[model samples]
Target: MNGTMPRSSLATTADVAVRRTVGSVTTPAPTTTPLRLPGVMDAEGRVDESRLRMHIFKNGGVSPTERGLVWRFLFGMYPCSSTALERPLLQEQLAVRYQVMKRKWQQMLPDSIRLRLNGTDAELVEAVRYFDQRQAHAQQQDQQEEVRDKLAFLELQAQVLFERVTFDLEELQEAIRIIDKDVPRTDRDLDYYLGEGSGNLLVLRNILITYAAFHPEVSYAQGMNDLCSRFLEVMDSEVDTFWSFSCYMEKFSKDFTADGLHRKIELEAALLKELDPQLYAHLVTDNMESFTFCHRWLLLGFQREFEHSDALRLFEILSCDHLELISQQVERARYQERLASKHSIVPEDNLLTEPQAINTDFTFELFICATILLENRESLLRCRNDVQLIQFTSSLQGTLDLNFTLKKAEEHFYNYCKRSAWDYMNGHCRTRKNKDEHFLYQLRSFFS
Candidate 1:
């Protein structure tokens, strides 16, 4: 597993002051015209849900120009059915709300508050414990005047200290400090974050800090920067970028939280046990928690496993939930040809039926994880125990092929669908309806 920098570290007073100095957001000017998806949007710029779904499912990704707009729909930040005219107004409204949320912490931060923010969570907890003990001792010394005056002074200071700590600004300060350290470390190899002042790298950090202020509950998680980097790459406007990232977090925050991380690890373990019993048994026999390796996979959604653009493509496809649509389109085309000629033979291994493109429901990602494990299954099973298994899994950081991995993921998904007796002759996989039967009949009649 990749080492995670903890969010609990304290920052210096100067660092907190620097963050507080920039209180307002500077909206980045639009640099290029937003590209529209052709068939997916009508003349009025309203989305065609079925067409959009099928296009993304079949194509895997949109052009770079069209990606931000497409992702807004995928993330549910902008409604798929919404018109282009409606989006700007919606974004304006969100941007106002976003600024309001961000300003709360900005207004409250001060030098005394900055000093109070410079403690880890454990340190803060211990501070509170010591205060309570001193208070208790103060009660016992009530008969001594000199000690009582000093105790009163100490009690007043403690009350002020706790008051500062209770402000949302304090948490925001801590999160910003952590983000400052982590931002420069983000994707440094890429040209995007390389420049010196107010670059996209700074924008990425701003998004994270702004998000921490807004959610406050999941203030900041370590791996969130990876998720935000992908969002920034797609969405140009900071407001759009921030909201879209928030929308992404809505579904995934649990995977990053304290309790939720463990639960997901266990969930993956149980899923592996069900999907590939042999691999699961080998893992348990070695006494390795599924999370020992699966943590990074789930945390960043295999972002590190592939190239940057490939990761973006994978994320957009996964967000759209259109894989089943593509499968139906392929089957429908094959069925029509078959109906047109009585002897028309569909190849057992048709090119269109292969899992060339992948749709990523979180469940679909689990399948991808399964595929990765199975890809490495032989080596894993050969391991004497957990040590060698962990070694193999951890070393898979930068070596996997996104395309091959996705193809295998799709195969796993299809086979799982098959094992459950997935209806192929039927049009709707989920509902088991023959939606294409009418088209099949028309083709047959025309040929006759």
Candidate 2:
């Protein structure tokens, strides 16, 4: 999708009108490497004017396009209007920049997403101001094609140099061991790490804190520290670590949502029932009809289900987008259909909420989680006692066949999608609006 809108200069996909959400502000495909900062503003008051500079510093650097937005907004080429403009703390030029920033972000997204970002009854200025710099630091750089080519070249050159050097695997391995072991897992309870991008552990903590507001219930789960650490361990840069983790969370969202987790468990159980009804019956015989223990597995993402090192490896592989489970999930759609039955589901004008469907992309996280469990299903089936079950899942640590698992999941996803209809996940982009519209319609009963 081109960032530039045609005709009226504004995207008309119903994403306008407070529809564009912060969460939907996704990093497009790989592009040039300009500069990127870790996460946005810290607990301290360190942001200066000129969004260009702020984003460049925050994200470590900016992509040409993002940089263009930064500069355009800052200089006043783009006006945010009341809808986009958060406030008028600065002169028109600066105020417009803030406006353009929120307006651009709010564009092409659902109104419900915007509401979630602003919450209820908060002034537009206050909300816009918050978003203006929230990602000022985390802004990922997706420069033009030429820049990307050059950056790729340099990376290749660096890779060659790395190969030429006498690298120490054992030493690096030792470092990983020590770092993974030493980092305090308790950082989950902390709101933010004042230390800032000091290392993988701290970087992980920072991302968690930054997103805590977006996902309040998930807050800071223990295993997330491990996930962040592994991402940094592989990505090397804190920015990359956060981006990768954020991407990972896209799929793993169900595990974190309150009350929804039970739905996840039910879906997982349903899939298992479909695939192996015999096993479902077996579990039911054991008083495991509720699928409780598996909650931690889905929630922490196998951190408790497997060894630390193994969990790290599995997550890293899943994060790489190289698994089949990513495509082959029926549970999400099944669950969405279930949600509709509760009457909480709504129909929206223009949007496709009349009958909700799961987005195929939503399957990505479920695929990873499913792949992890499906790979160990053979062993999982044999276990009788809870300890043995945990032990058996834990045993599936490092032996996961990454490629095979992803391929299988993809095969399942593609096939299932063909059998199903509509994009399940993306369809509900304006979920809040759907709910609101439905509620308001209900209120008209007073007139009746």
Candidate 3:
């Protein structure tokens, strides 16, 4: 555990008192503060991120009301150190920027197509360029031939424009159709997703579509709908959901890619092999590869394993970078306080005291995968064949305790860190030529 929490608990009083400030205005405290997760947030409504992270690490997850704002920081949509007052300004700026991007795609239609639909087109350079090229080329041809050629060229240009617009529209329609297929199936058991003509469903669809438009490269993967559902639920506003989802995709979009999946699958197998050699051998003997059972875990970050609320908490703790800058801030403040005290010893008994430095190397999920496989090691070892092993691991869905899993995963990760240090010190680790070499070198340097 990071540190034990304060003993006092709230009954009628607020669990956390955050001063509600918007822009330059500060709202007075409510007569009745709503029940919230104890100590995760401050009186200013800003997250005490380091404490919140450790709390979630020890306790599994936060209350439902706190998950929304907590997830914003986790998703990098909001900085951990940002004040409540700055949030309004930042959100307003992102809202404007989102509009600009959405409008950029919306205005991709040609004037002819836009005029027919009575939708104004702000981007007309393509059509203008086509006419300009035609005029320039026409000057070189015979007058009679040019007239005939102009008609043919106009027809061809119209066809090209129609085809281009048709392709774009087709892509959009496909994305919508895919989203439509998945939206109805998204957490339908929950009352929030149920009911016909739900506005939340519309918001979910729009966020996915907007993401598809922004990232045309990986347009609307199957699991993307499930991913967007959390964001939409957490953030009530459509604009906020869109931007938050976009920010989340920065790290998560890798899972949606073929190469990304392969990398994760490889990493999972390697980590598990290192963490539990016996389990690895059993899996290999049974012909059960990590990809067979671990793909979903990587793609969704174990969202399928735990309950919705628990999964949210697990993600927040996993997303925490241990606040390195905050650690530095603490160090600087300590130095200054000691200096002010005439070189007297400064107390190191603060709640934010650094304990085990977690290797925030994006391998926490790998550790979780290792823990899952290790948890079922006996059952896995009992399996007679690949089918049995695959079936057993496949059945892990919805049966995991987020708190236990995290605790076990952290243990495994600390072991990995030790092994990593040993291997680097002994020059037993592989020397890879890639983008990650620098990171490995840095880790080695830290250890050395």
Leading candidate by lDDT: 1
Candidate 1 lDDT over residue span 251-270, tens digit each:
77888876877876766776
As for TM-score, the candidate ahead, 1 or 3, is 1
TM-scores of all models? 0.65, 0.38, 0.61
Q: What is candidate 3's CA lDDT for residue 435?
A: 26
What is the lDDT for 136 in model 2? Answer: 57
lDDT of 1: 0.59
- The TM-score leader among the candidates is 1
lDDT of each: 0.59, 0.41, 0.56
True-structure lDDT of candidate 2: 0.41
- Candidate 2, 287-324: lDDT as tens digits: 34446657666665565444444454344333333222
Q: lDDT-based ranking, best first?
A: 1, 3, 2
Evaluate model 2: give its TM-score.
0.38
Candidate 3 residue lDDT tens string, 196-307? 3243554565567657765666668999888788777766556667767877776678789888888878777777777778777777763555445677777877887887
Give the Cα-based TM-score of candidate 1 against the true structure.
0.65
